[model samples]
Target: MPASVVASAGSSPAARVTIVLPTFNERQNIQPILQQLLALRDRFQLELIVVDDDSADGTADFVKQMAHGEPCLRLIRRVGRSGLSSAIKEGLLDSTGDLAVVMDCDGQHEPAAVAAALDLLIARNADLVIGSRFHPDASIKGLSDKREGGSVLANRLARFTLPRYRQLSDFMSGFFALRLDRCLPMIRQVDSQGFKFLYELLSISRGNLMIEEIPLTFQPRTYGSSKLDISVLWDFGVSIIHTLLLRMVPRRAVSFALVGLSGIGVQLLISNLLILLGFSFVASLPPAVIASACSNYLVNNTLTFRHLRLKGLQLLAGLVKFLVVASLPMLANIGLASVFYARVANDTLFAQIAGIAVVFVWNYAASSRFVWNTP
Candidate 1:
């Protein structure tokens, strides 16, 4: 709202654009991207918000130092926080611009494309304008064959969740521009934990927004290494599932349920192996149950409740707490199944399934609150 920030080169009224750059540890790449973006100030009123997740390499501090002289430049140093989508969310929400552009700070996303994307957003009166790497006219020399293939597969899966915007070539693209006022409602519903904020926005909008795509020329990063890892893939898969489930189920619940299914597999495998080894059914059951519970606890700690993941002494203490909280449910499972099997029906499978369902609900609820301290 400063007079200087609103001033544009031309007489035509300029839309104040907030260019949000989400960074982790891009100290090597930040300066160049910032300079390129700032160069566009003559054409458009621009506000550059660098959302840094407390990078160990002091990416935030560098941005802070740079912001001292530049009135349009600002830095949001997020301590004890991470994730690209969340950072983008925070940046967009904090923006005072009429339009917002979210892009990578690592230099893979072309800074020049910001102007084109914003222009298209205004020209087409679109709520969202995506800078798509997979657009037919778009050039992608940045991603390797493997990464491209993975992106292709992810976009395909993402399309299934987005029936209306299925034609979008790059749902996984990081660079995008949006009319902030139009997207504000849907943006609030977007899951910050998602790996792709565009996908989250598209899915949450439920085809209400007028969307368009602009060709993006993605180049390889010059300084920093790629953030692509197994954990990112895992988060992407979770995001897809979160969309497919109609956002009715909490993402953590889905992960918890999957972990529970794995626990069931462990229990069955162990129990069957024990039976083959001449152990009695009753004798094998306890060890198998205990083994499955331990497996579930460990996996839930690692993936289901990863944000509040236990470590070292905390791990041992959490395991103890998990077992204690799980005991009542474990007992109820056995008790309910026995009652149903003995009194109501002789169907062992039906009784066991009913018990498993109870155990899953109880364990997930109890473990979330007690074991992980998550609500």
Candidate 2:
């Protein structure tokens, strides 16, 4: 631990501190991190909760085995569900402590920072204390240059969503502490499906909370591979959009709209290509429409409604149901576009665009309720 990661001596030793570690296939990393956190029990009343996302690697089982001997250690095994933000939310909600700390089990988030964060939460009388990698005194020797650059860009974007905490250096940091009493109401209302739980908390607080930051020494992961990928970035982008929209629109709906826009592009591209190949505009439209609907269903399964993602036989079933649910809207899109092309605009692009717009809401609502069985 660096000198900058000093634990505050000002906090009360009797204060119950709950540390929430969200894990996914992090079997190798859990034990070491738990041991380090348990070491803090001598100074603070510590309760360690490992929220495991049904890791096939038996992460939950490992925690359960350890909990058998250690009263402070507990495990939450979530089946048929996955997502870092939700896991953290569930852990925090289940916490039986006055103060709560949320961090990663990947070993990248330094366990030593928890005490320092807790101290800041008490000493400064702040509602939330974030462990920021971008803090002036912070160090992130473990982060790659590319990852660091991406994080910097993400923090900049996050500031816009959190107008009250615009001075925050790391809106994306997984390590943070908060006074649970002040945050519980907001936590309950947080969009658990969002990519970043901290961002959701900060955004929901609307700067009304007295938020502060502590320097964090982000370490390299020693066990599992990094989960940062294109999908995570896509979710991050959607989160930003959700905040920007004043959160009036559902997060899933925002994702659906974005995916629908991509589908529109696919439809227009294929429709124009077929027309150029000597197919009549009307004849070219149905194939293009069907193709775009298929693209939307696949993308939606992977991104928009990932929590209810279908696989193997279920995936085939979902695609069939998606098409069936979409059939009426598909007909509406084609008929409206064809009418516009023949009578109103006499322009294929304009007609198709108008047609797609007409059924956008119906497709989202119907598919979500019927195919995905989600409201």
Candidate 3:
């Protein structure tokens, strides 16, 4: 609940605005983004809450050092758990501002756009304002085709699957702002288990939500690796499924199983490719099995048990536990699939689906119990 500010021009007080930065290994970009955001303190009351995942790069230490001088700066160093969506939620819950803006720590989001997005909340009475990269007047720099293409596909899928969100052109963009009073209730209610919290917000506020968008120029990251992977795609799919089957199943279990199902594709593709490259099925099997397990671990950590996500040494330790738990099921998957192939007459597709389904259940139960057991 730390709030800091520069003196406003008039005798009247400035409205509070909190910028929540959810970061992991973003030490290099931290100072620069802070400098930019700190420059805006004169115009509006600004507070910066950096919820970090215990970055080995000393991101939290640096923020603590900076906070000594900048009263508006606060750092929440999460030691055992980490996730972008959950980090944002932590920041939001701690924020004291009338308006809260969520942005990236990678410097991809322009700090300059924050004021304009905030203006929509204060003046235009917008329930939520998005800094849209796909806006007609927007520009982008250094965005990869793979990431951009994924964003496009995610947006399209969200629109097609959840028609209520069709009004948003950039459902995946992380930069956005809303009044704390308006968003806090929804944030508490939604399944905040995945990376795309904004999409979750939009989906939850389907009726009578006054949403607006402003053009924002997307820029390249100043430091750290992009978090995008096949797991992110799977997480997105799980979010869509969560939206579709809101009341039908336990969100975490369903999402975890869905991510495992996606990993089946990874295993099959890698194994098949190796076989095509002249490797024996025996030779290709181990790597394919391991790779699929790794994929599942990554996705489950980031999406399924996100609130209890691991970081640094804990992340590595969790992976080891995941592999140990997953190996048995991986073997079972091969055996079951083979058994189905041998017994079933013609429907190979059904056999494959049944095997995947069985393994999915096994993986989910084991992972939930051992790998990511957080209370």
Candidate 4:
């Protein structure tokens, strides 16, 4: 133990923690890493939980051996499993501590950073305390231009689309601290699809989130190749879409409703363009409405009603169902407005109101019943 550690250990508060580190093909790095973690038992008073996803290289055996004599260490192997994000989810579901800190199994995330993250969480009451490698005060040693550029560009794009998370400079860093109850719901918001946990979390959490960029010297891993790649980037984009829509809508049929928004955009765009081309209000309205309806039909059929697509019969049935549902609103809009104007209400405002409300109920029910029937 370092002499400085001896001084701090003698004076500190306690927050019993369960440290979850997910691993795959990391046997050579396991024991040495656990040694460093064990040396800090007195520092943070943590229980180390190693979650290994059936690593083909006997990584689980390595952890099992190291954890045997160490009273604070325990091993949980998820057999026939692989994803980093899912492993952490499984670990948290099984963890005993009220607080859980997840860090990369690779040596890249320094063990000391975990201690720093915990302190920041305790002092500031931060929902999350991220160990940022790109912060000016950070002690990054082995970061290349490629890594630096990737981090910057990714965070910048995410900021533009997701304004709430933009304030955080280190959205991609996985090393962080959180109380487990708050952490569970945030983790569930993250799909099993991607490894970018922070990207997904920021989309849903409205808590008093204070992100601290604790600059730490990032050391390159001495053993094992990097798992980060293009898939991670693709997942980042997926995380953004899921996070944004999930927040805007409810679970029942909201994703389907969001798909309808694109149809609305296309509908308005085409209608305006046709009107600009010197078509009469009466003549232009039909073509504009027809064009928009056609576009909406195709989009909602394929994208919005995706969950209902299973067997050939199911898809065909769903298509028939969607057409009937979509047609009712649209027909009622122009038909009711045209008839009512000609026979009863001469006011254009009253006619337009009649059409809009007709379409609203029509679309809502069709979407609720026919389009999104999977859930």
Measured over all alpha carbons after superposition, the RMSD of each candidate to the real structure, in angstroms, is 2.9, 3.7, 6.0, 8.1
TM-score of each: 0.91, 0.96, 0.74, 0.63
Candidate 4's displacement at residue 142, Å, is 3.6
Candidates' lDDT values, in order? 0.84, 0.89, 0.79, 0.65
Residue-wise lDDT of candidate 2 within 1-375, one digit each (tens)? Answer: 222223454444556789999999999999989999999887788899999989999899999999999999989999998899999999999999888899999988888888788877877878899999999999898799999999999999998777778888999989899888889999999888898999988888887899899998889888879988767888899999999988999899999999999999999999999999999999999999999999999999999988889999999999999999889989999999999988999888889989999988888899999899989
Q: Please say which candidate is ahead in TM-score: 1 or 2.
A: 2
TM-score-sorted candidate list, best first = 2, 1, 3, 4
**Tens digit of lDDT per residue, candidate 3, span 324-354?**
8878877876667657767774444454456
The lDDT of model 3 is 0.79
Total backbone clashes of candidate 1, pairs 3 or more residues apart or in separate chains:
0
TM-score of 4: 0.63
Query: What is the TM-score of candidate 2?
Result: 0.96
- Give stretches of model 3 more than 4 Å off: 1-12, 259-367
Question: Candidate 4: lDDT over CA atoms?
Answer: 0.65
Error of 4 at 297 (Å): 23
TM-score-best of 1 and 4: 1
For model 2, what is the alpha-carbon lDDT of residue 16? 79
Q: Which candidate is the best by lDDT?
A: 2
Weakest lDDT window of 10 consecutive positions for candidate 3: 1-10
Pairing residues by index, what is the TM-score of model 1?
A: 0.91
